[model samples]
Target: MTNAADARQTKPDWSAVRLHVVTGKGGTGKTTVAGALALALAAGGERPGARRVLLVEVEGRQGLAQLFEAAPLPYEERRVAVTPDGGEVWALAIDAEQALLEYLDMFYKLGPAARVLRRFGAIDFATTIAPGIRDVLLTGKTCEVVRRRAESGQGPGHGHDRVFDYDAVVMDAPPTGRITRFLNVNSEVSGLARVGPIRNQADAVMRVLTSAQTAVHFVTLLEEMPVQETLDGFADLRAAGLPAGGVIVNQARPIVLPEDRLKKAAQPGGLDQAELEAGLAPVGLADPEVVTALAALAAEHAQRVLLEAEQREALAATEAPMYELPLLGDGVDRVGLDLLARELRRQGAA
Candidate 1:
């Protein structure tokens, strides 16, 4: 098994991959990393024509739009826009009903049955509200993207017409609390479909997920709670026999101040006193009391820095492959995403 720590140090060669699944605890910036990785893969393409890349979000959260600085994507797979190098980036927010309908259309020839099932609350509840069933449909749709099929334009009536499209698929999957169960739907479906079409489809999806060609990247922050969750999530993935990818430490502090420097800065007789006196003296307002007040301000900043370092250290202890994306002062946008893409490429190259 590949260690997470090493994976963090190494950047992924997207050219060699077909599927990338991004997941983590909520608010850990998983979606941001997914978008950035897609951008990086697109930007790093060898040929400049236009590599087809699909960005899939399972929850309909519209997180990709925020990363691209565009509007929320609809349920369907739409050609949103192209990357800088002429590579295509298509975004899809998977609606459970649409995915189920697509699945039925492709497999069961249930054209009219789709609407009938929806009206009877069978398809609606199964695809939307049902726990494991929704996951099955979502994974099924993803598998369709990866499965090999011939393109003869024949409908389900022919039973031999299928299409395999898209160069790469990035799934912005569910949070850590539910992701294991979501991805394990194949095992759940196996009990029902002993050796039929559904079983075959589930097995194919499972193979891709478990294979070395695919990866599952977890994103987290440098805080205590998120780091703890990341550790637990890794263990869960391992226990479930899923391939564990590297962990992304998002919004990490760029510089860490040692204890000695932090203590010196917080001291009353440190740089703050002399710096304040120099400025005040120029204004003819030098006061010992004002110097003390300025020193307190510096001390507060030093304390915050110390706290940030502590958080970073706590995260580093996980020993998982870890990549840190510095927190931008102005917050993340398209330009920020592009910057992150460059960083990912650098890491992937390393």
Candidate 2:
């Protein structure tokens, strides 16, 4: 909290949330954030023991599997990583065609017909011509898991003791540009089906989506374009009556120099070559070109810091609970993911 980007609010209380939908700009690392979030939620409960969280990929990119350094995931739920406290982070890449098939089997018992359609390329044609069908299928599958209950059914009488299949579900949803349409697809379907099974399914998904138990968090970088998209995405969520969750700033460069020093170095002609050479002289050797190079590097860092500060200010105006993730020097691997998960826990995002 000492140096967080937004200080207007405290960390969100995620205890009530069961579905965490993460989306962002194309290059904002939304998938990586979703992966880390699954780990944090699984490991950071109040009385955590054997907690299982589902990390679902709707884009079919197997981004989660790659982040965990595993083979490409199937449509089935596969346990990918074990949390520090022995909890599990299971992953599943939700394929649209497969989801459609499952939907037919679950509610309509049309497995045979669906398979036949797939073989005839009807499923592909339908999904392509009506993309909303694909999104509906994917979101439906996600909600199914969010609402799944434990088979034991031996919890408290008031439902406080009831166990759930997963502690939470984190989705690597589509980019912000298309998230509104993707999430709101069910409502569109309602227009076509008034009171049939499809209508019921759409209504059910909407109920879960617009409820307090679901929150859509946005991932962004401290830059102009991504920040603008984040703002627009939040506005869309509000207009569509969707719940807005936290604002996670990913890969934010650390603020090395203090405020006054950074401002001084950022000013025009503030960095002097002679002064840089004098500072570098203490090292074994220093040359004029080296001084020039060092001065340019310091100037660039200073300017970047100043611009990033401006972007942070813009985001702070949203008044959303914010969290920052540092840029991994070695890139996001299994080790890097563990580091990020620990950071989320320390920041109370879990």
Candidate 3:
């Protein structure tokens, strides 16, 4: 019991954070990182309980479904997998058209008007070309679920079976290039929607977005462009009055060389050719040519080691909690994703 108390005390205190918005440069594997984060948060507690988290995708790309190895998800929520601590993860791909219809039903109780709107090009035009409306709908739906209030003080699986009563909601948001614009719905709709239900919806979403309950995490690679994008994204979130979460460095490679060897290799002509040749002599390759080649290989590895160190330093300068996901030799399959989830939990990203 003493040990249990200590462990509980040391656990990451993210209970107040209910919404996690993940975005990064394209091809940074932000989707995979978001899925793993959801799993980590769902099972973050040591004791198994009925905690549940929702994973959402808004681009209609079916990326979340692909990561979970499930069929494409409809707008409706469905159980995707169980976390290590027996928590549940529900996935939803928020189709713009469906979200619009749902919004109408919720606001106007438009039973037939929704079908009529779909019959015309209104749905397509609004979701495709109506600037900022699409963003409002996407963000509004996510925030609505995040801020859902259970009726009659009932829990999940109780009186009303509140489906949206999740402990947290992790969104596989748009890439860094569009994330700020996507999330800043209030600004986007301020010009177009001044005083209507649309404006009201945007305002409601902004309240949740700017609150401490929400955090937008950026995923990056240990490279120049992605790191720059992560920094820019962080700045944009701050400017938009949104809370910035930790920095997640994905597909990070470990430094294979020892500290002493790395230091020696960094110096000019510091490697001893004779020592390399002697080490290779046991394998019947005492040739000077072989030694030179080995030395070149070491130098190349040393350069990478130095570069990785510089990248990590830049990331650390952000002053946000930094978490790293290792590059799996085998590609990110189901088992690999689970391994990543465990790593995230260990690093306290949950």
Candidate 4:
């Protein structure tokens, strides 16, 4: 696949992937991972005009806004970040109610009638009282944006046109628990609309969703529950025939202790006070209190390393290509996000 930043460089592995849906267990940092992936795709094509990528959130949460350090986003798409190569990451927060209105306007051309439906609570029924339509609208709108083209500036007549085109679209999708139902448009709309425009719409959306052009990436922490969720989620995606992408392991702590040292530290009271004091003596006068503190620190490091190893092993069982993000000592902010994007690019997730 061509690089997201440069159409010239061929990185065929992920270049053909047009839609990237990121989902994981709650609190696994899927939103942060999604944002960083967008930035990575946005890096590297400085010479030619940079390619554009879109980031979307659908859970009514302002996660994208928080990560980008921007105000709460409206339903409309807006430019949120610029990459080193001048590529752009545009974001959208899909509001269920607004998407329904837009759907009516686009296909039915409801015009003033839309307000009447809203006033009488019909809009609420279709978007909320009713099931599946809301999910349809959310996923449908995202697919539409994925397929939308740039304005050619020439019109056969007077009609609205999409102003921008994206090389790829990244969705910070719902948690694993709800994701299958959320993306399974056929199942969602099956009971509600059997044979109408809504069903047809659901069909189109599913076509895009299950096609090779789209990939569903699962993010997870290197722990038991999240890893198990990742495994289960992948199983569901496979059962549904959805293309599963890579596994993103986030907030991984660094291994500070070397093997021999860690082995010694693992033993109860193995760190000798005299040895610690001797080491400290080179820098300055060693104290009994300092040696005790150092010994405690060694034990902690040993425990963390052992835990991390177990978690890493659990994550490896999933067999999906893995991408890891470091645990930022400082809280995650826009700058930290940029650093993460660089790491992702280096790891070839872009």
Considering every candidate listed, which one attains the maximal TM-score?
Answer: 2
For candidate 2, report its TM-score.
Answer: 0.92
lDDT of each: 0.70, 0.83, 0.83, 0.82
Looking at candidate 4, the ten consecutive residues that score lowest on lDDT are 1-10
How much does candidate 1 score in TM-score? 0.80
| Residue-by-residue lDDT tens digits, candidate 1, 239-290 | 8888777677677654444566568775666555676688789877688987
Query: Which lDDT tens digits does candidate 3 get at residues 1-350?
Result: 01111232334645678999999999999999999998888885644656788899998899988888899898788889897667888998987888899889988899789979999978987777676999998988899889877655564423334445887899999999888899999889888889989999998999998898998899998899999888888888888778889888899776777888987877789588898888889999889888888788888888777887788788766777778888988988878889998888777678
* Residue pairs that clash (backbone atoms under 3 angstroms), model 4: 1-12
Models 1 onward score TM values of: 0.80, 0.92, 0.90, 0.89
After superposition, candidate 2 runs with Cα above 4 Å error: 5-12, 153-162
lDDT of 3: 0.83
Mark the regions of model 1 whose C-alpha exceeds 4 Å error after superposition. 1-15, 69-71, 148-164, 190-195, 256-260, 266-319
- Candidate 3 stretches with Cα past 4 Å from truth are 1-10, 44-47, 150-164, 268-270, 283-290
Model 4 lDDT tens row, 88-206: 78899998878888888888999778878888988887676666999999999999988887765532111323344777899999999888889998998898889988999999999
Off by over 4 Å in 4: 1-12, 45-48, 153-164
Judge candidate 1 against the unseen true structure and give its global Cα lDDT, from 0 to 1: 0.70
Residues forming the 10-long window of minimal summed lDDT in candidate 2: 153-162
Supply the TM-score for candidate 4: 0.89
